[model samples]
Target: MDFLSWYDWITPTNPFASLFFGVIFTVIIGITVWIDTKKLKTTTLAMIVGVFVTIFGVTILNFIGFYN
Candidate 1:
């Protein structure tokens, strides 16, 4: 599929989906910012690893048509 079509297909349209997506991003940002401010090297590293893991897991699920 083309980029636009894929984007349109994946983009959240329902209110719950939008809220969930927003909450996820907000949490990620909040965690990263909090860790940065605290200067906790181990937690920062763990968060980075976790974020990457989550991204890869979501990407795999998307490719497997789980979202559909």
Candidate 2:
């Protein structure tokens, strides 16, 4: 009946772990970008680069059977 108990279910062995972290990171980045009005362009460009890097990194990891 508590949040920690529910969070305990999302372990490294769980299939949703990667997805959960990915969503969490995306949300964090979104919030940072939303709050910084002065450097929005630079921040967004950096986020785009980060996204591409993550995509390629995950694809490479999966291709090499890192998950298995």
**Best of the candidates, TM-score:** 2
lDDT of all the models against the reference?
0.56, 0.58
CA error at residue 37 for candidate 1, angstroms: 14
Candidate 2 residue pairs that clash: none
- lDDT tens digits, residue span 2-67, model 2: 223345334432324544455567657866876875487767775676666656666676677765
Q: Which stretches of candidate 2 lie over 4 Å from their true place?
A: 1-20, 33-37
Q: TM-score for every candidate vs. truth?
A: 0.46, 0.54
Per-residue error for 20 in candidate 1, Å, reads 6.0
Clashes of each: 0, 0
In model 1, what are the clashing residue pairs, if there are any? none
Clashes of 1: 0
